[model samples]
Target: MREARMSAIGKGLRRRGRLMAQAVSPPRRNPDADPGSGPAPDPSWTAPIAPRLVPSPVFVLSSVRSGSTLLRVLLNSHSRIRAPHEMHLRTLHVRLSRSFSADAMRELDLDRAELEHLLWDRVLHLELTRSGKDVIVDKTPPNTLIWPRLHRCWPDARFVLLLRHPGAVVASLTERRQDPNPAAVRAEVLDYAERLDEARTHLNPHVITYEDLTADPEGVTRGLCDRLGVDWEPAMLDYGAQDHGTFRPQLGDWSETIRSGRVRPARTATPGVELPPRLRELAKAWGYPEEDTPTP
Candidate 1:
């Protein structure tokens, strides 16, 4: 099987790496016991010992609490789409690109961009194997903050921008009582919008509003399917009907709703938070009702 071959190849490479490390350096001692001594140096292990291949088919971009979880469940329900739980891949991007000087990049035999693509392939291949799906849709909202990096790594990657009223998104965050302050959330939304604009100039990202998704589930989802180039199955209609079983761990506040396997309308208010003027501006720009403007 392909999986077995990959597993065997990985183990063989690791074994060879250990042998090479032994050749270059003395046998390793436990770092804890040798506190005065430094750790063993395995410099050759820095670069990948195998050929690189990776693909990025889809990316779901959004602000926090922008109904991304619901959209993910809807898309993941489709026969061909596999929108997995949030991986916060922006962190992965950060780590892989964190220490790249031109010299270091050359030593690693991959520039930061190539490393990012290879990592996407590495992670997605494992994820696809587990989910038994053909396509990958990275659903982490923070990834929107790194749109340019994503574009550099996977220029052909399609985007789905999940838009929600800034008020509603802030309300949800406030309700959850997460560590992020309301001001911080607003600023993050503003930056996400800025990056969204930049991304639009390059890639045609499909925009899906949270209110519309809640108001007309089927119509919104069907349109989304058309944009994504996948046929809409009626089973995608009943979000709760499918049993995803006890696999695919959902992270963050999303875990609760996604675990329920259902779609619910957003509630209007949350405790101890009011709509700020900046968010109101954002809402207006996104064509949502401003604080003073009543719904038509």
Candidate 2:
């Protein structure tokens, strides 16, 4: 019994000694670190770092099916330019702003300044991906509806407004049934066009018509480049081959057609496609000749 008691006491002493040694010794450094190294601090442990600032992107606003895609493709052909499909960033801002006005949304921590900063950060991140490019174009179609907000967001950023005959626009919309809500699309287009005109009075944005773009893409693009201070690139005309894999999937099969690298006239003389009379009248108002109107 005495021997067993002594053995227990010896084990206890060894354990106590180990405890004392552990308490006195400094903690071991990370095995991956050098012997003298201390804790490796996180690169972002100080604060959330903001992305490097870039110039605000040029915004193209226009009605759907109005050659905005063609312009975007053409502009993107320039080695110095990166044009992506309709990002609808301005629309997001509008929705966020509206959300903040609701009392129920008060607790969501959303506000104008926060939303603006968030959008700025998002845009900056996008710009960084196109780093080294001279210009980035946001080719959002519905962005035409929020021109004022876009102008306010980037006062110095250039705006390119694409004009199509409302008749052509309405005809295209009716044929494609692209707008799920026809009434809403009609109202939105009319309101957006009027608002665009109003905004131009104050902002003096560059306006290019679909007719001009289709007739002389290179010339119009050159002029646009001059106005926007970008160099004219022949690649813009052949931009159909460029990959647009990053655009949102909801954009439809149009991108696939654009990828085929064709810049045919917008109004093809397809046989047997009869356009309704109302659409013909609408097209006429927008300067499309009644006789040459492509069948729907």
Q: Could you tell me the TM-score of candidate 1?
A: 0.69
Per-residue lDDT tens digits for candidate 1, residues 1-296, read 99999999999999999899989998775644423433333455444333524355688888777777788778788888887778777666623322224345657676555676677768877877777777778878788888877766675678888887665666666666657686777566667666665665567888878878878889998998898778888778676776543534345343566567666776543434455565555567767644432232
Candidate 1 worst ten-residue window by lDDT? 94-103
lDDT of 2: 0.65
Model 2 weakest 10-residue run by lDDT? 43-52
User: What are the runs in model 1 whose C-alpha is more than 4 Å off?
Assistant: 1-56, 93-109, 178-182, 197-202, 243-257, 268-277, 291-296
Across 6-57, the per-residue lDDT of candidate 2 in tens digits comes to 9999999999999999999998756544434333333332222223245456
Candidate 2 contains a number of clashing pairs equal to: 4
lDDT of 2 at 58: 82
Off by over 4 Å in 2: 1-52, 91-111, 178-185, 246-249, 252-257, 268-296
At residue 216, candidate 2 shows an lDDT of: 88
